[model samples]
Target: MTAATPPARVGPGRATWVWRRWGVALRFERRSVLVCGTLAAVVALLGVLALGTGSLRLSPAEVLSALFDPDADPRARLVVVTWRLPRLLFAVVCGAALAVSGAIFQSLTKNPLGSPDVIGFASGSYAGASVVMLLLGSADYLAVASGSLTGGTVTALLVYALAHRHGVRPFRLIIVGIAVGAFLSSLTSMLLLSVSPQQAMLVATWGAGSLNGLGFEQLRVAAVVLVVLLICAATVVRPLVQLEMGDDTAVALGVNARRARFAGTLVGVALTALVTAAVGPIAFVALAAPQIARRLTRGATTLRIAPAALTGAAVLVTADFIAQRVDLPVGVVTVCVGGVYLAWLLVRQYRGGRR
Candidate 1:
């Protein structure tokens, strides 16, 4: 890790590192790199703790040895390699995905509260899941996953349609998203109400969310989707950094604001949708991760996605560890903690007169 670098200059002929597709170049800060490494290390430690602290406990060293040595105890391997590893992996990957999604929205809207959860994607996903699990009476994984993807895509399109007049304005987008999100949440509630008691209870339990019983197959699917989205996110980061200087400035500097918004929103929604489909809506990871990442790296002006992604992984992995011990759904733990952070942010905003 080294000292952070300043922002990159953008133009037709000059760049630090230019992408092939346009006159796009990326700026990197060493601090963001350091933050990612530090957060990754933190996540690794928490992962070890999560694996070792369960009922069939093992030492950290034992965990490592078991991971490496193929001839290690079958029971140890079964628990660590098979059962625990999938959930642990999902915790880190999905956490990063949610945080990155949050960062994209925060940049687009210039609002700390802007996130997929608040912006209707999560509610849309839950509404989708409710349709499958409650209305269609199907608890199959494919059914729920397909429902979430379709619902999230439709919701994104709906929000875009409602927000776009001359073009999509970030403020209007957020306002419309919140409104749509509320409506979807209500739809979910109505579905819950209309279901049989047993079905409702099952849906409510899933709504609280869990990583339990997540198989490697699910991880494989999520990993593939996340990788593609992350690549898209990387490409859009340059334009997004320009967008922070104001839409007109971004356009003047050769960044297409509409394309940036479209790319960012699409990637962001896909990421959150993947997580929601996998583990249900783990609340507030998206809303808080980017801001936390910004603070961690002291708010790098270069659109700070890496740090945001790292911070998200740490938060979710740590939250999962706590959730396991407390016998609560990971969603509950995240929501409780996120609720406190939200309250504090609101109070601070009120005091700062930003409202």
Candidate 2:
């Protein structure tokens, strides 16, 4: 093991630490480390709280025992592991997935508000799932999941095509996404109106997004998919970070700006689609997590993927915990909470523009 080298750069109250060992160098900022670590701890604590506070109401110790000790009480193990654990894990994974997706889009567009929710990917996904539920009348998880992925992918392609005048510019992509999303929303509403009230209600309930009945089966597949998507996200991070500095600068630095944007967009949409497919369109996590993470880290770095992911996990776990107590869909909790945050964000942006 090599000794920790001194920070390469230092400022008034900031330093960038670089650790090199066996020909691999890792760069990190202290603030980013602290923020990511704190968020991870929060997520873990919230996960325990969530696992412990269900109908049976196990103590934290009981939850830990049930999780780790195979010889724990049968009932306790059944409740914590067989029942509540999947939902908790889903909240964490889905939240992280959504947040990372948001980070990618926001970085690509260089806009705070650029998220799958705002740009129509979520809407498209919901629309797709609604078609499976309403038209096909198939409530099978796999069928609906396929519809969602298809719908979101097609919508992204459409948006990309429309936005590609010379190249896929960020501003144009956002505008096109908004318009496409609106169209998809209206189409979904029309489908709902055309369908039986029972079908409409079913789709609506799923759209509300709860982690009520998810089990290890669903979690297993989603975890695998998220891992793959996140790895792809990692591959694009360096180029995306360079692109954040402006296309000309990125080009000067030997980064492929257009390719990076396209790859980032693909990965971001896939992440959103993964979550939407698993639990329906849980709104605001994708929109709020990255921004919240960025602020919590005080903009320590341009690409705050890890912090955003951890922040997202914490936010979703916390919201799911609240939802479990209140018997409401987790999406409802997020919307109510995220709506206020969105309003404040809009006001702040407006004021900033005026200044």
Candidate 3:
């Protein structure tokens, strides 16, 4: 009789608790949306500034007008539509692609340092481009892109194969990648040395990864490749999340781990190749973007791919802006900034371990 009386309906308090939990979730979602919105706005503003403040210096209104009405003043139209817009688009697309690729690699390897650029894909592409430029004497964009894709894919396969004892271990993959990267880099240096002075100079500037010469054609190619790869990435996102669990759990959950890994590696390699072709070996977008996104999201499984892509786009566009204004190489700016950030990340990891 006492037990029956004690079963006072869990009515108002339970409802209140449910409501509070929902409210907390809504609040968290709102905060994430706000942060992402702010980031998008900032990136848009920076893009506008970058377009406006170059040697031509078009105002925001003029830039907008020129972008919309291509038949406007030919010079202004050309500067905005033909020249600056393509570069801006290239920076954004390349950045997003690289960032997404990095996030995929990091997740697959379960290593913070895992990225296409860090693991020698970019360097391998560079070597491929160098060979095409020097030996074949071809500056054709398609040829360069093809060469980059081949080089990066081959390097990825080699790394994977070398690292496969039973399965791909993170440390072994990294070590193999570094060793291969060094060998490819030395080969590139030798090729550069063998070429004529003019070719060498051209290669040197390209190697520094400036967004100076990219036109609409290059932008179009990069966009197509990026879109396709991104679509594939989206399709695989759920499986990839499952794959992040142990292999046995993933298998139990109906994930084909080996196939998923292969698909992810291909996508990652393709992205790196596209970026390397568009802008020669711009480092750190892939490395930094995912890390930044994870920090911003702060989820237990915080590989925010879309956010990472956006961050990468913002970083590259901003970096390109600085590079153009300061007359420095985009690669140089990225490496310097990325190096500092990487050091800070290492320190943070160390401190976290102590705690």
Candidate 4:
């Protein structure tokens, strides 16, 4: 009882420890929200800027008025509502779709390089679209979307089948993906070579990825697909988080690893297919966005998916803006910008390993 009086004293160390833990948790939540909010804001601002500063050059006020008032100048309203709005929406939707796809694939494979583009899914979709554009001379969104889904799903199934031996192995999956991607790419090249010059040119330009001339219909299709996939992604979020633990641990915690993987892969493939069909396989948004989000959030990997989607939207919209101003393709701008970031990531990984 006498010693209890002395024990009532609070040490500064204990208070400091509690403060630090709480501070860290608070900081993390705030940072995540901040990052996501910043991305969203940037995307919105870019959309406004893109609408105003295109070839026709409407003021921001004019663009806003045109957007809100149906009775605004028909020409300005048509440009904002019919033409540019669709492209802007496509940029946002496709960016988010590709980013989320990359996050899911990276989580499933437990590798940063396990994105659709790296793993042949993108190439497969490209192959499918190429066949439609080059062989059948059809740019119909439905045809392209169907072909892309078919090609990407086939590629993913093959990779999964090849990589599965009792259970999927990450390294084997990556290796198989690279091999499959190479084969598909070669097939695409062969098809391009076999096509007539006009068809080849058309396919090649689309392959390089341009948002030019995209109308409301394409944007609407992509938006519907993206929204559906996003809902699927939400359902699997808890399971995915558990699966990030070791297989045995995840199973013990009641996560059906196989089911989770299947669902995640299916959603991921669908998203990738939609983006590829809509915009011709814009690269690196999927790969880079999740990585950037993870670094920014500094949380467990699973939390990065939404933030990645936002960041991807921002990156793609910004890139599209630059592409339009410079008279270059969206794909070209993304590749150049993402290539630089990717190189930096590789170097950072190398340095971390050394440490």
Candidate 5:
């Protein structure tokens, strides 16, 4: 085993911790931290913008005042506090959770296309939700959320059972998930087909994924879950970084490869399930946030959790703001935007590889 070494220099004025022991090497740079901080500040600024802009536009100054002063402008209070605030929090919290979850899956699978849905959670959530609307005639928010959780749990167990061959192979797990996701999606479609027009419309609207009508209660629950999942992420993140060097290298570095894989899988699925439960499977934030964060920070060798989470928060809040103005579901906007980004990402990756 090697002794704890001092911070090493990476770039000018950038300090890093580089450690090696038991034939394993690990390093961390201060740059990621700095980038994450900047991104967090930007996200906060965006939150203010979200609070300010709408049919009733308040300036950033007014937004801040309304936030702090209970007896501020009555209109600002009504809009900011009772109307827009909870949705903004939902966008930020859910977006960050999805981005972090996506990052975990992408790192786990070593595939850029790796998303929270890659584990079948989206389909499962939809399936559960659709069942609630169609079979049980329950369109209540809590009922839908409960159904989504149950479906996600079923999908997770099924995928694990199919994918486990001695241990969960990353590629195999992804393949199994895709296959099961397709099946679950079909189940949702069948339910949609069989239901009455009113029921179908309800399920369809929810499936389109809206941040509409989110409140303090939902945000409170999501916040607690996200906090716990984040702690789990922190404890297992080092192993994730190590695994990026390859499974053998990860093993040499004292990382439990199977355990890390399962942890990532668990976190990724749970995050997606919770978000889907809250807002109905929001499209593309999870898939794009990590990639955008990596680009913005220029950090290829690290997980970039903070930057990714911030980017997701920014993206979703901005989308929600746009949705508010247009009276469109936030999910629809994300899907449209995500479709373009996904195309661009594929093209860029292809060009880079050819180079």
Candidate 6:
């Protein structure tokens, strides 16, 4: 009797790599591996450039030496390791988190526009952080992080409850998220109005989402938290992907659609909130990264988590690099670029619908 092949196989024609160990198996698409690797390399190269380019301008060699060689110049080490490394790490880590959040939401909603920024979660987090900043007058990391997380969690629950009717609908979720986000934004603005100019300015600059002045302390905590959240994300990702094949199909395949969606939503919210807490709300990485990955890979895979994340890291690092040259906040550059990308997406969808 012949043994049946595992379900993970994508059939005979596609290029796939499979690994088996301890009676377990893992399957990966070759193209995805290549693309993700290339994107990772791009991110690393960008990081090196970002670390190297500054007022003191070190070469790539100097950046590497300062990073690795203990005997390297103290000034070079201070500039690369002390001053620039944290910011670059923040960009990469936060960008990946946002992109993963975006991928999760977009998959759940089956809509390109289903991002945290579009669906009210980012606004909720910002509002939460703003509350801490203005009302509590606490600029402390832990306080702001707590407030942001609470706000985002509340917002997610609110959106989920509002969108639920028989079951949660993607279209309804998007509409409700937008409405809630707008309301929360208005409330945030009111809070800003109530604050003193100095306080308001602090909140405003934070809201603009700059990675300036962040250091090892913030990065260490944020990185550890993000890693934990990402591990949670990975656990839910397979079931989440199954759920994408429609709830009925997913259920038949032994997946609980509602449970998967719920868990995925929580992970996505946490990811966004963590970044918002650390660096404020960064726009468009979540929205654009997955779509960009899809196009770049020519829609070769339904699972987009890895590629989207890598693309996000590269995109944010590149944007931050540009931001440094222009002496602007990273958020401002993403807004300008992502605004254009969003407009283009809208027009494309409109044209497709008309046809």
Please give the range of 10 consecutive residues that has the lowest summed lDDT in model 6: 1-10
Q: Report the CA-based lDDT of candidate 4 relative to the real structure.
A: 0.84
- The segments of candidate 1 whose C-alpha lies over 4 angstroms from its true place after superposition are 1-28, 163-171
Enumerate residue pairs that collide in model 2: none
| Residue 265's lDDT in candidate 2 | 76
TM-scores of the candidates are: 0.88, 0.93, 0.87, 0.88, 0.86, 0.94
Once fitted onto the true fold, the runs of candidate 3 whose alpha carbons sit more than 4 angstroms away are 1-32, 69-74, 351-355
List of clashing residue pairs for candidate 4 = none
Superposition TM-score, candidate 6 onto the true structure: 0.94
lDDT score, candidate 1: 0.84
Per-residue lDDT over 133-217 for candidate 5, one digit per residue giving the tens place of the 0 to 100 score: 6898786667877887788777877988998898667778778988999999887888788878887887788789898888898
The model with the greatest lDDT is 6
RMSD of each: 4.8, 2.0, 7.6, 7.3, 4.9, 3.2
Estimate every model's Cα lDDT from 0 to 1. 0.84, 0.86, 0.82, 0.84, 0.82, 0.90
lDDT tens digits by residue: candidate 4, 1-355: 1111111223332111111342242112556667788888889888999998776999888999899987899999988998899889989988999899999998888888788988888998898888888777789899998899889988999999988898888879988998999999999999989978888888889889888888986777778778888988888877877888888999999888889998998888889989888879898898898888888776668336679889889889999999989989999999999888778877986898899
Segments of candidate 4 deviating more than 4 angstroms:
1-30, 302-305
Better of 5 and 6 by lDDT: 6
lDDT tens readout by residue for model 3, 252-312: 9999999988888888888888888878998888989888877775543435667888888
Model 4: per-residue Cα lDDT at residue 218 = 71
Model 6 spans with C-alpha error above 4 angstroms: 1-9, 21-23, 299-303
Lowest lDDT block of 10, candidate 5: 297-306
Best by TM-score: 6
**Candidate 1, residues 186-225: lDDT per residue as tens digits?**
8888878887888888888888978888989889988888
What is the C-alpha RMSD, rounded to one decimal, of candidate 4?
7.3
